[model samples]
Target: MPKIARINGPRAAFLRRFLPLLLDFDKGDKPTGQVTNEKRKEFYDCTTRALVLCFGYENTLGNDSPGDLWDTTYDEIPAANKMPKLPEPESIERDTVIKALTPVVHTWYKNRRTEANSPAGRAVLTQRQVERTVQAFAPLAPPPKALDVYQREFKQDYIDAFAALWAKKLEAAGTDEDALKVLKRQKGGKERAFAAMRWDQESDLKKKEVVQRCKDVYADVVKRHKSLWGSPHDALPNSRMWSAISFHRRSA
Candidate 1:
């Protein structure tokens, strides 16, 4: 708060210039200026993701929960009686997956937190022979609304097959044998997300180190083996050393 109060502070001018606009933009009769509503929304999504990653990327890399930090920070705000009160956002927890087998690898930490903290409320049902009286969300249209809440029913045997399938994936986890070649293909697209920036830098450095190591090893072997086999014009390449070179290149 003192830092914010300081007139010469780095962000003081920024806050002063933008704070009123930020507070007022959520009000009625808003002017979006040259930007269209769709463009504003598109930029909002990208900006929100970028800012969130900036705020939480290091904590995420260190295996901490950003959501917990958000809650803790919110609780520490000083209260003023005349301050505008912002109502909490409306949220309705939907039902969890049924008898389907859940993959631990694919499960997101956020969804796990939601599942643990928020229970699905009882859905209002029909009194008679279930003519679908209870559509949980009143604002939602009837059927064909692209149900993200639930999956289409699958046979028990088909769901059971995923166990064996993922078990094969577990066996192939670190090997070059990616099931869909996705891991290998995505390597061409260098990591662009801010969330993985540190990891991406480390990975790139490791690749350069590996390439340098390979070059050094190649040079050392050529110099030493040249002493044994004489000039390349006088002698053919050694079969065993060439085989080893091939093996090392594939491993790299």
Candidate 2:
């Protein structure tokens, strides 16, 4: 008699327990070639549960709680003695899973259109339920919009440029009394304090000079930091700059 190889390991042990449950699609007696609404719901529910299990297993090996598995990719399971090789769970990218499952979903929809065109076929999934299904398996949110990305980069660049200019102006003047007074009144919000500096000045000429100097510094900083704000042509609008300055003044 030939001896059979025995599968042994934590992974094998886990699969032995859950794999059958994961594949257990049949609940009871069902009609042949007919995909009912109940069946569709059950299928998605089962898939979601199976994903949770896989996520749990990955989390357990990494000494992390299963609850902490949302939006995170699982690490590759190493091949152990007598265990089968497992692919990294992270291999399932958004496009990859959608590509693989979309065909099946389309086939089901086509079948519904041709064969099961009754009320059962017309049953639509709720938005909440669809959201839940997506949240269960999706590794990350959709990428940010182009405008949002540009705005974020611009905001950071503006902060760095403003900081450098403020430092330089302080060094050149040897005293930042007016700026410091505005800062104290504005409770140390740099943007607000800087804006307040113009209003706090008693002389109209001095105020005009302060505002012009601020505009000049901003223009120079933008020029110096052009690379950080995406393209060289991506300039901050004068209206937005003045509005930002006035907003701080009003807040102060």
Per-model C-alpha lDDT, please?
0.28, 0.36
Clashes per model (N, Cα, C within 3 A): 0, 0
Report clash pairs, candidate 2.
none
Clashes of 2: 0
* Superposed model 2: Cα runs more than 4 Å off: 1-27, 31-33, 36-92, 95-252
True lDDT of residue 69, candidate 2: 19
User: Model 2 Cα displacement at 55 (Å)?
Assistant: 5.4
TM-score of model 1 vs. true structure: 0.16
Residues 1-252, candidate 1, lDDT per residue (tens digit)? Answer: 011111222222211222222323334365455444444343333322222222232222222223211211122222222111111220010001110101211132223223433443112111111211121112332222111111111112122343344445546665656543664344213221221333244455644554555455445545443444344345323323343454588999
Candidate 1 error regions (>4 Å): 1-39, 51-64, 67-252
- Scored by lDDT, model 2 comes in at 0.36
Q: Where's the lowest-lDDT run of ten residues in candidate 1?
A: 90-99
